[model samples]
Target: MSKLACAAEAGMLPGMFKRVVVFWALLVGAGWSAGLPLSPKEVVVVYNANQPDSKKLAEVYRDARNIPQDHLIGLELSAEQDISYDEYQKTLVAPLRKTFDDRAWWKRSKNPEGLIIPVQNEIRVVVLMRGVPLRIKPSPLPEGVKVDPKDPIGGRTESAVDSELAIFGIDGLPVQGALKNQYFQSKKSIREANLPFLMLTARIDAASESTCERMIQDAVEAEKTGLWGRAYIDIANKFPQGDNWLEAIAKKNLEIGIPTVVDRFNDTLPLNYPMTDASIYYGWYDWNVSGPFLNGKFYFKKGAVAIHLHSFSAEQLRNPSKNWSAGLLERGAAVTVGNVYEPYLHLTHWFDVLHDRLLDGNSWVEACWMAMPVTSWQGVVLGDPLYRPFLHLNGDGKMLAEDKDYLLLRSAAMRWGNDPEEFNKQLGMAAERLKSGTVSEALGLDLLAAGKDTQAAVWFRNAKEHFEKAEDKLRQDLHLIAIDRKAGRKAAAVQEIREAQARYGPMPEAKALAGWLDILEPPAPPKALPK
Candidate 1:
């Protein structure tokens, strides 16, 4: 069983018993909202004043995004990743509040809950540089208090600094577990809403300073030329709740003409799986980074956006070999998000919503905060928050030939969303003419999903012949093998499987074939005819 399924079966999914109560308390809003757009002017960049590199990164990002010069603020902070509560308030919170007050960046007034909060904020977004602390360690609840039943996570206090800072400007609310994100799933923007403003904070941080700088550059380049590549989604079939999110994402990508690989296996994409041209990736439930990422030879295409859904995926950002956020950054993912501590599943970012918003042209930070159930929790947004992967979706300027097929397919999909038959016909023509494995494989997957296995086989075969990468070709071969088995060509399927095993022995993909072989040719059944 998958991790999520096991947890659910074991009755260990936190807040499951009273999820309705928690959802009503935190997410009492309408259905998913449209993207809340942001401009560079509304952003404030923060960095550790004592660290020159931190300040330099802030400047580099600000200049790259054209943010206002005066919007930058620097404070002396601890060099550690985890900060104590008192240290957090004394060094980071208090100083930032003072800066906002002195600079007139916001107006503070008595909130109805009877605490001072930003009532009219000129700045609604914040960007933290690499050297700033990552998270705040948990503190004991004031004596004689028990866990809140209505909202189980409300009693826990450890959180990412970016998460906590989001609501620190809202009011002097006690730094507890999770608070209601009034804007979550709501169509209203902070300026247009009635509640006190909640600042949206993202960090341009990674394992190295150079990586941070490159992330900024990549975001800019991707926006101008557009991010065109396949999406690799690892679906941990743990439970329907998480599975639905990934399935929806794959469906959406298919409709939008982006080639996507949706792995239905309980685990992540196998090690060293042919994962070329990966511009987008979303997976979950691994304790730490694993699979192809561990191979050290697999690098995401330039300006790639990736995320893994482990509880402590972002626990540390300084070690390239450690957590999800750091490992992804080290391996060329330009944008990613994860939890700095144990963020319960319900409170974490809804990656499906994040993908939808990004496709709708929302900036990375806005998409993340817009999808999160609540801020002041444990999630942290890393990389350039202003990056929008689909901002130039339909445009074709001086982009490289490598991005052409993706642009062509995307433009066609956008133009033909209401008509599927016509869309497939056009895509098939493109695939045949271009002889692109990515395009051919995408069509095959779509066809397979539509239950046209015979048609899918043709495309899969074409993809196998055209693909250059060993893994890509093998992936197509697997698709063909499955189709052959479905068509009752068991002998042929078994022959091809053994041949592939011989061709790629000891590889993860070969291991998958071995699983298929076991199923097709099981151990000799006992001679039970006597019964």
Candidate 2:
């Protein structure tokens, strides 16, 4: 059995409780309103007053997300991405908190001694616009402060600015090795909806201000059009922990019926294999994944979520057209999760959890925060917090006529949409292979390549329903969900998951489908008000 099997068997997995109470609690709008993603109005934008471009970038983002002008807070700070801990406390954390307090952004109360208790914070997300520093080098502990035994590195440490925001108020507290995320997987811990907002921050920074501006625009478009495309997962067989996490991610994608390609090798996918229409990507352990996709000219679908796991992968994002996170942004990915400093192996975000939660319909911020084990550490979430990729997969999973996936697929495969001869050739080829059940799938592929995706989707389904064996048919059904996603027919794909569950009985994949279906379901009706 795999580690996941053991965990599930032991019932130690997060949110595994089958009880009604647990389910209902989790079902509550855990940080989201019904039919809405995280609102831009709830976000505060931070920029470095020291950099003119930073202010300009903030303005562009505000326009894109409709963030209020008052939400933009410019602080006098260094242009560099790395800073000392003292500098962070003095310049970024302390000053920002003071501004929030003075502006009455949220309510706080004080005791007789007059120490304020942060009762309610309205700002759920802090959007670090371009030019803000990315990390803080660990400062030495104060005299008489004992070292945390958890510091396997013997007191040396560093922190990501986004991570430290989880504990933005605890600036003067004694330094520990790292702060474990208390709400890491707590279904009830999403205090954003009813209580004070804490943790959860995203940054918009890249090689250039224009790139940052473009990211904001792309995210808005993706949310409007839907996040429908392929997923590419690459794993470097290095440490067991990292490898296991990546493998789990691929496995979960397969279980959730996402169209996916996984490459487990020392190297990444070669440049020649087309990676067009990719909406999701995760790869790791190396400083960077070398591939054609890295070039600024390569662009994924508008709402693509891409991340390369590496120490210091997010160390800088000022060059909108180059290096790590910024490079991905320049190349058109909307979301990038990375580290700003050496987080060591155990402190990084778990890719498996990230995948599962996103599929569960959690917005990017909620999903990222839930998966991250520690805050006040090295991880940084870079994207729009309210972007929910799976929101497109709701209801009957039927593809909407307006879904961008249809257009994206048409653009990539069907020159037939442009050329009549290509359309005729596909029609001719599809007819020839329809006679052989085993070869019928090839016909669908040919049609899909010619951009006759609706016809191709029908053929693929027929191959599964009529020609494929039980096990093979089940797999095909899952793959068809990917096709459904690409064609913007998520309602049909969701129905496929239901049919598959009935056919397979209580299998692992079936159970995963049930869980995902819950995520796709609308929030439970609000409890009746008190009589």
In order, the Cα lDDT scores of the candidates are 0.78, 0.64
Mark the 10 consecutive residues where model 1 has the least summed lDDT: 20-29
Top-TM-score candidate index: 1
* Candidate 2 wrong stretches, greater than 4 Å: 1-36, 108-117, 148-150, 192-197, 294-297, 319-323, 395-531
Q: Where is model 2 poorest over a 10-residue stretch in terms of lDDT?
A: 404-413
lDDT of 2 by residue, 1-531 (tens): 322332234332143213312322343324333233566767889999988888998888888778889999999999677888788888987888898889887776663555554567767778887788888877777678676686574465577878887668542444546777765764432553443636478888677766767777877776654577667777878789888888787666543334455655465544323354477888875555456454334577788889888886777776543447766777788888888778787788888788777776677888888788887788889877777766544211233332322322322222333454554344334334333233344345545544677776676676565553453354445446656645667687678768777887843334434544454454689899999
- Give the winner by lDDT: 1
Query: Across residues 1-531, which tens digit of lDDT does each residue of candidate 1 receive?
Result: 322332233332243314322332232232323355567888899999989999999999988999999999999999999998879899988889898889888898886788887778888788999999998998988787677688768788788899888877755677677877776765455445555468888999998899999999998888777788989888888867778888899999888788887777565665556677889999877877887687656788888989988888999988877879899988899999999888878788888888887776667787787789887889899988888777655443235657656755665566555687876776676666666777788888888867898888899989888788777888887778877776778999999999998988776556667666766788777887764
| Local error of candidate 2 at residue 81 (angstroms) | 1.8
TM-score of each: 0.85, 0.67
Local distance difference test, candidate 2:
0.64
RMSD of each: 12.3, 18.4
Q: How high is the lDDT of residue 93 in model 2?
A: 79
Count of backbone collisions in candidate 2: 14
lDDT of 2 at 228: 72
- The residue pairs in collision within model 1 are none
